[model samples]
Target: MRHTVERAMAAERSRYRRFWVAEHHAVPGIASGSPPVLLAALGARTSTIRIGSGGVMLPHHQPLVVAEQFLMLEALFPGRVDLGLGRSPAFTAPVRRAMRQEEDPPDRFADDLTELRDYLDGTGAVTAHPVSDRTVPMFVLATGQGLAVAARLGLPAVLGGPLLESPDLAAALAGYRRDFRPSPRAQRPVVTIALDITVADTDEQARALVLPEAWAMARSRVTGEFPPLEPVAAIVDRPWTDQTRRRVEATVRHAVAGTPRTVRRRVEELTERTGAGELLVTTSTYDRAALAASDTALARIIGG
Candidate 1:
């Protein structure tokens, strides 16, 4: 994963805005469990690109600790650190128990967000240190309630997953803008859309490139575990249940994968629908070479 980030991102540093790592604990498919640790390493390898979390799940840790960690990151990297916060719970019941999070826990997201911001802004009762004058911008990874919280608090929002394809998407974003409050952190509303994007020579090839991720997600829904990505040939040769096939098809349909022109058109449509200022490509495939090529093609499409 580190090698992929270094090659795909650092190679074309000017093409990317931020290299955002995700936080997933005890998920067999995901290697990253700590965003801060990963961000520190990525930041050292690249100079211009922003390093941040796609996000850190706030429910898993205290607000102060989060603030201190990001602040330390800002100190190390200076003006190039971002902190994206999310309210997602642990992966499973056992993982939740392991993390000491209650099953169906009460939502403390808004409260935690407020406290964490206070520490970053040096307004909390206790200061989180290695503090500097520069601010580490915080973004909320919005789903449903998260949008409202972000709007109310005057923070930028990162929207992804099924929400991007929701019938009420425009309405949801409109509501976000309609109810948004401006703060010192942000004087205006900013929306960034996240999707799994892949580019290849042809539409079929592009779709195939995303099959491993789609397959993994499909099986995870039924098996209760997100297994490691398998090669495209291995995935295709294996027998799949009817349910798996449907789920895989659904996932593949959601991902934007095709030739450069095809991808550009889809991306433009997303921008038109969401009025998003940025696109967060979360594409993952087992073929590292193909993935890198896709990244390169995607960068070219955006004139990066």
Candidate 2:
């Protein structure tokens, strides 16, 4: 845990502007189920860079609890906190039951988001202690109906590559931008697209770094479980069926990885195509040193 936080500090030192922790449940080999705990530590350790949830899965939690937690984060970090939320349901039926959340009707995401917003603004029956003071901005992680929610509520949306991968998605996002209603908190529609961006000294090195996670992704699909990342050397030596190789290739193909120039050009194209205001990047590698090295190389490319 300390190591991960330190890497975030390193990323900030390397001039990455924001750090977001995700909320996941009943997942092995992932550690971001409690965004508040992680974000608070990050808020205390780093200065200047924004710290946020990427996000709190609102369906599994109470709106007031979510409001108070993020408001407390804002209080701690002052002007450097964000409240990113997603309406994703629990990962599985068992997990949903474990959280004591109903399965049929499910949690009312839109209403919860509205209530959370009201709590943040001190306009609800329940007051969020310490008061949000309208300083902490809320961003919705969206794709389908989630996008509509963001548009209707006039909040910024954070979309992943899946939503920016095709023309239909681009068109949908354009519609979102066109029909969005501005709230007092958000004056206009803002979009941030998340991508898997990896950069290294050479194309081969960049691909090699992605191999561990990519292969694991393929292997997990076949095994019905998401496995821990393996070393690249081990992944390279695997005897794979043709279908497995194809699956692995497909998983990594969504990413843009290469030498700095190659990555930079692709990034420019991605931004132009998606019309996104910010880029949230996710890079995964088995070797910690290689990951950090890639960030350093990218830092130079971005003049960070």
Could you give candidate 1's per-residue lDDT for residues 1-304 as a string of tens digits? 6674566354445467778888999999898899998888887778888888989999999999999999999999999999999988886778889999876688899999999999999999899997779988999999978999999999999999989889988888998999999998889999999989999999999999999999999888888789999999999999999999999999899999999999999999999988999988897999988988888888888773
- List the candidate 2 regions with Cα displacement exceeding 4 Å: none
TM-score of 2: 0.94
Cα error, candidate 1, residue 262 (Å)? 0.1
List the candidates' TM-scores in order: 0.97, 0.94
State which candidate has the highest lDDT: 1
RMSD of each: 1.2, 1.7
lDDT of every predicted structure (CA atoms): 0.89, 0.84
Q: Can you give the lDDT of residue 296 in candidate 2?
A: 84
